[model samples]
Target: MVKDLKGVLAALDAQEPGSLLGLRETQWVDAKSGPYQLADHKAVEELTKDVAAFANGGGGVIVIGIATRPDHDEEVLAHIVGVDPAAVNVDQIRKLIRQRITPAPRGVRIGWSGADGERVLFIDVPAQAVDTLFVVPAPVGKPGSPRTDTVAVPMRDGDSTYWLPRSEIQQLLSAGVRALGMPTAQALIELVRHAVSEAGPGDGPRVGQGLPDREREMRVAYEQLAEAGLGQPAGEAWAQGSAALQDLHHERDGEPGWVLCLVVGCPPVVVAVPVWQAIVEAGRHAPGQSPLAAIGLPRPPAGTDTPWVIAADSRSVDVDGGSWGAGRMTCSGRGVWRWQPLPRFSLHQGRSAEIGTSGQTPALRLRAVVNLPWAEAGRLEISKPRRTLLEQQLPHSAVAGAVTMLSMRRGADLPAARWERGPFGNSARSVGYSCTIAGSHGGPALKASVRLALPTTMESTVVACADVLIEDAETWAAALGPGWETQLGFDEVQAVLLAAWETAAELLPDVVGDVAGLSWAAPPTTELRMTCEQPADNGVLPVLDEFVDLAPLGSNDGGPRSRMAVTIIAAPAMGRAERKSLLREALVRMAREFGYVDAEVDVV
Candidate 1:
């Protein structure tokens, strides 16, 4: 089972010693006589049926050109009647199988080998979570033999093929659903258990609070199934099998930071596997072209570009987080192909999302996770009046890092999840984003939380803040003299803030709004007035606005700490809490700048 190329080589080696006649026939293994020519329509149909059975059932290998040894009395062994390489057409056979199969199997392998002076074709069909019965249309006779092809559902019974009974078809479908659900449930249980075990002594009671109800149901179902001695190993197998997961484990297995996890349920809303896979693989390296361009998410226009601030500079956003680079690829198809990011969402305590179409859709569930280094990401935050400086830089930079991650290939929708203030409001220490990024074409999707918490590696929030301050000083020349002019234009600054505010509002619709109003007076002695354009329910501003005035200390003053006055304005009748929220929002927006703003807003 573990054998891939190694297994093939081992088979070839074993053939040298003696005939492979006595090879054991397991549920996952099958053998077929050599179909001399793929032009033999009947033979091709039979092969398609055999492969489909293996996929619908547990995964198995079909060794073609193998037949029972005539001289041997035992039924255990078979002789390799190697295929004629020249006569056998692999492409034609593959195309036939792909066209006939309802939903193509994932990870199917086709290979050829010569053993004992004979060539053989081997097809490795991987088990699929979607229970789709593969049907070959009729005309049991030759092509165009006065008979049209009739759809016939075939199932493998031991060493034979039979029409799957209607009752069994229902049962098989149910099994397929269980196959997908049970493993997911089990994996989640394992995740919660892992979280509990890893939590510090003081963090005892909150281990699984973030688990979603759907996940909880899955956990219960998985437990029940396990008790019945019927469970799925798919989730665990997928996690182990993914190259992306392996890389993440290697790079940041135990480090604490924000994690974006994707659970892509197949048949995607878009059934373009070839295109999807291309982009996913291409995204791992410097793609031949901008992968996002294929998916219609081109880089922003000039002057409107919201650059990823993670880069040391404000110039370009080039981050490659995905580990596996693309290999050679050549595609031939009818339509134009485009790339799309994998579906993904945030996963943390108290947040989760579920998305997909109804029960009618067939899907193979896949899960992937991306871990963002807290130390590096946290370095984007700022303290005092410069927090906006960091927030402003985070989106594009974080996106570049996140997009390139191999795990992101599993992320389905763009902007799957966006950040929102947490229960205690925004903090340099922690924040959470939520969204759903998984599903088959019209299938339901799942949601999860992406939390940016203080890194275990960092001593305190202050330490993370200091890291950014120091970096900002060097990067943006935050230590410039009093007479130095700010290089940021008012429009550019407004655009950046508006962009972030919009993102926040999108992620936290109930709490935040669009830029109702934005007006900034020039830099030195700058007067900035920001407030919600539309008033809340009672004709009063939902949140109050504030004006901050800062006077620089003399050049000889120690580190920069200017004289500051924070003027709090009450929206005619807005409450203290609303005023506070408004102030926090203002602070959150303004903290991204290294310069100062000093002015008060008096409502008209």
Candidate 2:
């Protein structure tokens, strides 16, 4: 059973089994009366949409082989109809979803449960860490309409699934999630103190001189949050049904002035452990450390001497009629530890301006929950400096960098010299690099400073995970479609591969010799042309068109020793034996270059 299955079962139990129903269809539950044989394309498409919808929303369950009565009102229960055990093939459905959904929903749990002496399929879809909306391509055509090109954002609204509106899509696209900014009332007071201390002497009222100004500003901030419907800071007479009022009267110990509090509720986190593990494994350090390191941050040290995770507290509360949980995950190393909560910030204002100004975007509220483990690994550490250093000497410096290249042939034939003049050329090449500088931070505990060697790329784990997901086969296949072919068994592929080897051989002439005993029995045809038989109505002469034709080979596994196979179509003028000999010579030369070998030779 999935972790949330108990909750789902509880929901189902609320309705009696024989009361003309089973469980009412809600935003999170979908009841279908029959088994989905994914071999049926329509069934596959429907399943894809439902999965996408549940992933986009707060995650939900799809109960197949469950019947519902239309005559009943909102309380209608979808009773069990039972699935055909023989017809159920979990692998096929899993594969279909993997092939069709872009950035395919992670942590999708599918199982069979017995009910009413019959088996029903339960598909539990987990909400994504971020707004990773799945886009499934429309298949050929509808029953009554001709084929058309379109995209879909399947989302669940109320009790049904539909393509979400453009406005909603825009909102999801622009929505941002950060670890709740300040996790506690004390943290907020500390931040205020830090801000005031950081300000120059000429800035707004100092702590003691700006007493009235501070009070007025605090009141204004409170009113702004109240007017925006975030609720009054706990103790106001107008406050009603406020359960999260623990910090209503919270204030800095030394500062007696009034203060405004604005709290925004956030979404519950859905942890997908396997996906999280994959991301961490793909990273450079410990099992789950790379996701954080890649984004220009240091991974917390882990071992027998250090704990992998330390959570201080966790709890759920009702806010603005929505239930949101706030919890902390801390990682410590070298006498430094940082706390990151589900609703990360205890108090934060989102504005691209100075802190004291009224630049806060009250109209725009932000909220997000951090997935456990993976997100836990990404919270920034707060270092405790033991000493201070004011050295006059320059520090030793070193540059760290890495580069990865994915090279491939583009055209069907050997490049025409003319192709070089065309913009972008014919061959395709992509390069990625990660570069960082080594630096040092020195200070005492009072300065709260420590040595720092950080990456220039400072992105959240959620963003970094999304980057890593791009390399996943399911994600790439779904995004590019089945027709995406990277390898073609054309002469051009061989040419490119050989050219690279030849260049390498130049630097190691002693190691690589000329195609030792191989000789061209017949000069290979480097170019082929086809001429049209007739001219157009303009009466122009017949013209010959040069074309590059290469048969698509299979995908490259992206390993250094992976073999590259090339197919060479012999010229029509060549004899069978001659073609075979030419093929043998080419294969031998390729082997000598340690590139690609000729797999086959075909003569028309």
Q: Which candidate is the best by TM-score?
A: 1
On lDDT, the leading prediction is 1
What are the per-residue Cα lDDT tens digits for candidate 1 across 9-122? 345322331234566454666666766355567766677677777776766677777775433332333666777777667656655565455444444556565543576777
Model 2, 15-77: lDDT tens digits are 212322445678887778887756566777788888888887878878776787764455344
What does the lDDT come to for candidate 2? 0.34
TM-score of 2: 0.28
Clashes per prediction? 55, 9
* Model 1 stretches with alpha carbons more than 4 Å out: 1-21, 70-75, 130-132, 138-142, 145-150, 170-604
